[model samples]
Target: MILTDTHTHLYSEAFDKDRDEVIRRAVDNGIERFFIPAIDSTYTQAMMDLESDYPENIFLMAGLHPTHVKEDYKRELKHVEQQLKERKFHAVGEIGIDLYWDKTFLRQQQEAFRLQIQWAKEYRLPIVIHCRESFDEIIEILESEKGDDLFGIFHCFTGNLEQAKTAISYNMKLGIGGVVTFKNGKIDGFLDQIDLRHIVLETDSPYLAPVPYRGKRNESAYLINVLEKLSDVYGRSKEDIAKITTENSKEVFGV
Candidate 1:
């Protein structure tokens, strides 16, 4: 049972107190891979430190998050670019248009998203997107930029079947997480209809914790809650779900 958490901020300040213990618990629970997404340059050092400590288990990504976009976005984008050129990262992500927080930087967010996608293509790496309350907008951008060079995961996907199909058409895999266990999450109703190959598991830790741990701080160990829920949704054994999703993640991150 080699579970892969494709999106988790193991480097988040939320785990500052006992990050190592939290990681050990996840490892004990069979989580072997942890993909860390960048929010901005602010957490860069922490993420680097995390990878340094767990070189085999941790993989890093470089990008400017949508909500983190502001008047100084260009500078941040430059920093992402410089980092990508300087070293290897698994992907260019958790990047996309986020309208849930503030629409003030919508234009900047779109521009940044497109530019990051181009950067991902340039580096021959997959992207990890953070689509929140702007599916239509993100779809429009992906539609325009669609090509052989573009592909990645729609991190923390919580959309409908049609949207899932649309994302797949653009070479994006659906990233399922704790949301699938939510009573009103809605995706659970149609998840089984989607192929497991198009799905990857995640926890989006420190957020979106599954039931039983709902509203509490989420850790990678809680991924078992999601894996259990998915076992029911897909009508497969927990070990099967873990194996298939881990394979799917390798297809995305190439690790």
Candidate 2:
């Protein structure tokens, strides 16, 4: 069965010592596709190098992450624009408001988010959102910009049923990840109520590792743990879940 990890930072330094082995582990476990999200201009070269190393499996995205928004955000956005003009990317993402860590750049974050959404529409590409402690703010902007051209995945979604429905209303697929396997990760409670077509799997790896691996560094191969949890949550076979979620990912990323 082929599985898609719609959001993962394979270029992250966390896997610097054994990046190839990490990728091989995932591929051997049937998780072939890895969608890499952009954080800032600093990681652009590393991301390119990753794609260069594994062109068949790596898909790139260009955008300034909300947390990275700062006084020099304008220059960063320019870099994103230049990258888009120079080549191809499957999406513009891992962008949105993140108020959890620091609210100092709240206004800048909102502006960056809106500008990136406009860019996504201009390029006719999907957006992968990174939302944290700002669901209301995120939904408000999405409401103002809602339309046919605005569509993507809500990466690492950790909201309630109403928020999930709201995200779906905006043409976004819920990106389920290792959190679903956590005993207290509430999304699992109501996930089955939402149709499988609106869900996609992700690891956000080197980050939210699934149970049996929780509290440790995450990897794409652990996506199997997530798949197994989803299978139990939705009462479907693991292969079926893989097929449906991977198909859902294709619909969002257009790959």
Candidate 3:
């Protein structure tokens, strides 16, 4: 019953007070793997410290998040490049266009996204995308870059059936998270139609907490809530969902 949280910010300040306890609770409940995504150079040390504390469970990624793309983005990308060269990361991710908050940085976000994808290809690593209201924009880039070397997870996927199929076409596994448990989170409506092989579990924790915990800070242990929802959605046992999604994660992260 091992479960993998393919995208979570365990290093987030939200967990600063009781990080160990939060992680222990998840591990005890079978969510043993936590893949951490990068936002910017600001959290690099914190991310490293988290991995140092839980070497067995923590897998880190290096990339500049789309929302974080600002005037100094080039400097930030340099940091991402340096980290990738100096250490091992399971993926290059949490990167993509995010037009939800503001459209001001859309151009910079697109450039950063494309550059990161090229870096991922160069490093021979999977990419974990952070898409938000920019599906059409992201899909255009993906369509142009589709290839054997360009593949990864579409983190926190909240798209329609056609979008889901398009992401799968680009070798991306849909990263199902707490949103699936929401009454109005539409992904749940068509999830079962997509094969379990193309899906992976996540919490995006400290954010997007599942029902019963929604509107509150989320933790990896709450992944059980997501697993339960998915079990109901796909008509499979919880253990089977855990096994399949964890395996799907391993395929993407190569761990």
Candidate 4:
């Protein structure tokens, strides 16, 4: 079985202590692919180092995360554009709306989001979206700018069935993470509304860890919890879950 964690911060400082060991555990449990999302230029070196250390297992993406948009977002977009032009990236990603943190950068966030989507379309690479507390606004932007050519994943999807359908209409697959296992995550209620083919597994590690490890630090190794939850929700074996989601990920990242 080959499990693919479609989104994770393998370069996160939180993994400084024993990152290798944690990754080894994930590998032992069948995780073979890890997609690392770039937040900004600040973490570029760390992400590069991670890919350098684990060349075969890690794939890198270049983008400015929504929350990371700041006063000089043009420079940030330039950095992202330069990186995209100079090298190959799996996707233009971890980019979307985040009204949960601050509304100050709302316009900037939408600008960055649309600009990144343009880059993705120009490059013909898929995207990975990170949305929080602004689904309506996010949908608004997507509806305005989205077309047949733009497609991607909605990372850590926690929305209801209708939202999932809306995202799907935009050619985005729903990235199911640890949220499905939470008592209040609630996405499980609509599991049957969407099929397994439109689903992809992700840990969004060093962030949203699954239950039993909830409130604790998340890591790639914890994807097991997500696998178990998916097995239950989809009524499939873990190996099947891993295989299908891995296949779905390949369709997105073209790995």
> lDDT per prediction?
0.95, 0.96, 0.95, 0.91
Q: Compose the digit string of candidate 1's lDDT tens values, residues 107-161.
A: 9999999999999999999999999999999999999999999999999999999
lDDT tens digits, residue span 67-153, model 3: 899999999999999999998999999899999999998999999999999999999999999999999999999988889999999
| Model 1 steric clash pairs | none
lDDT tens digits, residues 43-81, model 2? Answer: 999999999999999999999999999999999999999
Superposition TM-score, candidate 3 onto the true structure: 0.99
Count: clashes, candidate 2: 0
User: Which pairs of residues collide in candidate 3?
Assistant: none
| Candidate 2 ranges with C-alpha deviation above 4 Å | none
Candidate with best lDDT: 2
- The lDDT of model 2 is 0.96
- Please tell me which model should have the higher lDDT, number 2 or number 3: 2
Segments of candidate 1 deviating more than 4 angstroms: none
**Which segments of candidate 4 are over 4 A away from where they belong?**
none
Indicate the TM-score of model 2: 0.99
